[model samples]
Target: MNATAVTVFHRPPDAESFEAWLDWMGETAFAAEGFVECCRAVSDDPALEPGFSVTFRSEALVNEFLDSAARSRVLAEGEALGIQRKSSDLVIVEGELPPPGVGVFHHSVADGKAADFVAAEAELVTLSATFPGFEGVALFCRGDTGRWFSVLRFRTAQHLSDWMRSEQRAAALPALRAELTEDFSVVAHTTPFGSTLRTVDGRTRVTPTWKIAMLVLLVLYPTVMTLSRFLGPVLDENGAPPWLAMWLSQIVSVALMSYILSPAVAACFRRWLDPVDGAGWRISALGAAIVVVLYALTLLLFATVKWLHYWDYNR
Candidate 1:
C-alpha cells in the first residue's frame, strides 16, 4: 500500500439520505482498487458540524475513484439532498502503511490543559513506539472544541491488545486522565474486524470499549476451544506443521468472529449497548436471559457430539 488519502464532507440536513449515500459510496469504494477503509463522525457539539473521512491506499487510486462515474452519481445525489462539500485534502503519508489494527482516540480536554496535555501526549507517543508492533501515532487538536485526537496504527489486533493491557499504558493513563474533561473515546478500524458502528444517519457511534472487549471474549472462547479440539487433530492427521495448523485455526476464528459471531452478539445486545433512558434494567435482564439460553444450547450441542474431546489435545 502507498499513502493514505483523506477526504472530508460537510454533513447534509437530510441525515437519512446522507447516510444512504454514505452506504452506497462505501460499498462502491470497497470494489474499487486500493481502497483501505472509511469512517464518519458527527461532532457532539453542533457548532462543529458533522462529516465523513475516507482513507485510500494511494493518491492515484483516490483520483481514479473521485473521477469515476459512481462518485459523480453519489455527488449528484448529495447535491440533490442539499449536502455541502466542505473541504477535501489528500495527504501523502510518508513511510510504510501501518498494519491492520488502526484506531482513533478522541479526548475532550479541560480548559488551560491543552498545552500540558499535548506535552504529555508527545511523551506517550515516544513511549508507545518502544512497545511491540507500534507502527506510528498522529496527534491533532481541533480548533473548535480544543479536543485532542490521536490516531494509532498497530501491526495486528494482538499487538494492539498487548499495548492496551500493558502496565506502561496503565501508568501513563492518570496523567492523561487529569487533563480530560470527560471520558476519552476510542474507535478501532482493524481491517475486517474493527469496522465502525454507524447509525442510520451515517454518524459513527463507537461502541464502548468494555462492551467490545466483552463481546470478543464471548465469541472468541468457544471459537478457540472448538477449533483446537476438533480441527487440530484433522490438520495434524493431514501432516500439516503445528505452526501452520495453529495459524489456519486462528484465520478461521477471526473469520467467524468478524462475519458471524460479532454481528449476532451485537444485535442481541443492541438495546443494552445503546440504551434509552428507561430501558436499562429491562434490556439488561433480557440480554442476560438470551446469553444464558445461547450458552446452554451451545453446551448441549457440543456435549452430544463426541467427535473430539475438549481436554484431550496436547499442548
Candidate 2:
C-alpha cells in the first residue's frame, strides 16, 4: 500500500458505544474509493485509547477520498457519540503492539528527497531481513502529514531486539539520517505475556494487576495446601517450632509462585489477562469460571484424600 490513513478514536466510558461507532465507521471506511485493507489494534496502555489504520494501495485514490465532501458526511454520525476529528501529527508511535513483534518507524523525509530516503531504508530493510527470525517490512508514505512509516516485522521479540540493537544498525544510522529531514522514530508490537511483563522503550503494560492476583491465588492456594500437608509435618516432627514450620512452608510457596506456577498459569490464561487481546465479558467469565472449577476440583481432591488432610492426621 502506498498510503495508510491512521485514525485513533477516543474510547468512551463504555465499550458498547465505542464498538457501535467502530462498526459504523468501519463500514464507512471500507466503502472509501481506494480501500486496500484495515488493521485495528489497542494500545498496551489503556489510557492511550484504540485506533483503526486503513491502508490504500494507491495514494492518489485515497487522497481523493480524504478530500471528498462525503468524508464529512460519514463522520457526522460519529458526532453523536462524541467523536471529534482533530488533527495531530503522527510524529512517533512507540509502544508494544502484539504476537510476534512489529517495529514502526516514522521518518520525516524532506521533499524531493524520497529517492535517497528509500535507498537508505531499503538498505536497512535488506540487512534486517538477514537477521534470525526476520519476517518482513513495509514502507508507506503518509501523504496526509508528509511522514513515512516503515514497519518491520519479526518472528519473535528477541529477533526484533537483535536487529534493533545490532552494531550494524548503529553504524548505518548516520547515512539513514543523512537522507531524512528529521531523525526517525521506531518501536514495535508487544503485550507482556504473564509475569514476564517488561517495557520496551517505555511501552510495556503489564496484564491487569487484579488478573495477575487471580492467577497467583490459583497457583498459591494448592501450593500452600500441599506444602502444609507434607512439609509442615516433617518440620514439626523434626522439633521445629510451629511458627518456624509455617514460615518455612510460606517460603516454598513464594518460591514456587515466583519461579514456576505464576508464569505457568499466566501462560495458560494469557489471552484473558491481556487487555490488548480484547478479552471481553465472555472471555472474562470463562476464565473466572475455569479458575472456580479448578478450585472446586482441588477442594474435592483434598476432601477425597482424607488421610492427607493435616487436621485429620493421627486421628
Candidate 3:
C-alpha cells in the first residue's frame, strides 16, 4: 500500500535559508527509494506552521527511511535552524536546513557592541546570498546566557566550505572579528566513509558490519603479508631502521588499499557486500562462510608453503 508522511514544522527565522534547503531536499528526495512525489505547503498566516508531505510506494519503504542514518543526519541540520519536528520523514518547512552549515559556531560579541555585530551580520547575510547553495542565516540571542548566536545553512558541505574559505569572507573577517570578542568559529563534517556508501531508491544503507569486517580482513591481510614477504627484506638490507621500514611498508599497503585493492575487492564482492542487493541472513551467512574458508586456506598456504616464509623472521 502507498504510504504518505506529512511533517509539520515551525517557520524558520530565516525564510531564505529554509527555502534553499527545501530546494536541495526536493532534489534529494526524488532520488530516494519508492519515491512517488514530494509536495510543499506554505501557510499565509504567520501563526500557522508550514509543512511538507512525501509519498512513497509503500508504507514499509517510508518506515525504512525513518529508521535510516541519512534522515537522522538531515533532521539534525533542520533542528539547528530553529526548527522543531514530530520525529518523522521530511520537514516541509513549507521549507529547513542541511546541517548547521558553516558559520556554525557562535561568536561572543564585543562587550557593548552587540548592535555593531548585528549590523555586521546583516552585511554577511547579503554577501553570503550571492554564493551557490547558500541557504539562509538565523541570528538570535540566547535567553538564558544572553549570548549572540548565528546559524548559516548551506545546501551541502562543499558549498559551506566554499563560502567559509572565499576571498570575500577572508576580507570581511577583520570587520567581523572587530565586532566579536573572540575569533569566528566554524564546524564541519570531514568523514570520508559516507561517500563510499550508496543511496538506493532514495534511501541509503550501510553494508552489514560483519560483511565489511570480512572484506577488510580479506584485502588487508594479503596486502600486509605480501608487503612483508617482498618489501620487508629489501628495506632491512638497505640500512633502513625497523620503524622506517615498517612505515614504508605501511605506506604501500595503504596506497594499495585506498587506490587498488579496496576498490577491486569491493567490486568482486559487490553483490555479497550490498545491504540492499544481498541483505538476507542466509546470503550474509553464505558470504561469511566463504570468507572463513578462504581464511583457513590462506593460513594453510602460508604455513605449508616453504618459499612464502623466507622473510617471516626478517619482517
* Clash count for each candidate, listed in order shown: 0, 5, 9
Q: Which lDDT values do the candidates have, in the order given? A: 0.64, 0.64, 0.63
Better model by lDDT: candidate 1 vs candidate 2 = 2
Ten contiguous residues minimizing lDDT sum, candidate 2? 86-95
Which parts of model 1 have CA positions greater than 4 angstroms off?
1-99, 188-271, 274-315
- Candidate 3, residues 1-315, lDDT tens digits: the string is 455555656677887777776675566667689877655543333322355556677767766665667766666877787667532333211101223333434577767886677667777777878899985555644443425545555677677778876889777768778877666533222111111343322234567676777877877887787788888888988999998998999999988887777777676666677666577888878878988888888888878886788555554
Model 1 superposed RMSD (Cα): 14.5
Scored by Cα lDDT, where does model 2 land? Answer: 0.64
TM-score to native of every candidate shown: 0.37, 0.41, 0.39
Better-scoring candidate (TM-score), 2 or 3:
2
TM-score of 2: 0.41
* TM-score-based ranking: 2, 3, 1
Number of the top candidate by lDDT?
Answer: 2
- Which residue runs does candidate 2 get wrong by more than 4 Å? 1-193, 196-204
